[model samples]
Each structure stands twice: as C-alpha cells, then as structure tokens.
Target: MLIIALSTNIAMLCLVSAVLQIVLPNDAPQWLIFGNIVVFVACVYYTYKAVTVWPDEEKAATIS
Candidate 1:
C-alpha cells in the first residue's frame, strides 16, 4: 500500500544520500543533502496524508 511505498521511498532516499555523501569528494556541493531533505519532507507529507485518509479497517489490518 501507500504506506509501504512511502517507507520504501524514504529508505531509498536515505541509502542514496548516504552513498553519495560517502563517495562524493570532500569539496562536493551541498545539492545532494538538499535534495535528500526535500524528498524526505515530501515523503513524510504524503505518508501523513495517506494515513489520515486511510480507512479504519485498513489501518487496523496494517497494525496487526
């Protein structure tokens, strides 16, 4: 479901960000960090919206 998608997106973003930070030169630009922050924020917003709109039954099923 959407929650899973959002979580995966967040995880991928974090992984990519970490790899970029580790592999990029020490003097590399800050764009990678900024992009990671933006994507993370967007994912969190979408996850909040999905949770708020999800049906009670589905939420319960997810919890269990």
Candidate 2:
C-alpha cells in the first residue's frame, strides 16, 4: 500500500511540475525536469515490483 501511495504521489508530482513549467520562466534550471522524470520512472518501476511480490489476497482470505 505504501508503494502504491508513493507511485501515485510521484505521478502527481510529475504532472504538477509539467503543468507549472508552462508558466515558469524559460531560464529555469535543467535538473528539475530531469529529476522529476527519474523519480517518476523509479516510482512506477518499484510499484510494479512490489505488487508482483506481494502475497495473493484471495489466498489469504480463503485461509480464514
């Protein structure tokens, strides 16, 4: 769940940053865009990994 939240948060940040850039100065530093893309990709990659590794929910419910 934490990973899911993190994924969504990073996605949101990427969207917001991109949107803001439309109005931001043309001279804005280069690293901010690069950093956003890197973090967004990492978040999505990790979220996919975590979900695949998590135990089956249906199996756990059936045990009870």
Locate the minimum summed-lDDT window of 10 residues in model 2: 19-28
Residue pairs with colliding backbones in model 2 are none
Instruction: Tell me, by lDDT, which candidate is best.
Output: 2
Cα lDDT of model 1 overall?
0.72
How accurate locally, in lDDT, is each candidate? 0.72, 0.77
Q: Give the local distance difference test score of model 2.
A: 0.77
- Clashes per candidate, residues 3 or more apart or on different chains: 0, 0
Which candidate achieves the best TM-score against the true structure? 2
**What tens digits encode model 2's per-residue C-alpha lDDT throughout 1-64?**
8868878788778867865764677765668777777777787788788888888889989988
TM-score of candidate 1 against the unseen true structure = 0.55
- Per-residue alpha-carbon lDDT of model 1 for 1-64, expressed as tens digits? 8675866689577668856776777765678677776776677777777777777987789989
Q: What is the lDDT of residue 10 in candidate 2?
A: 85
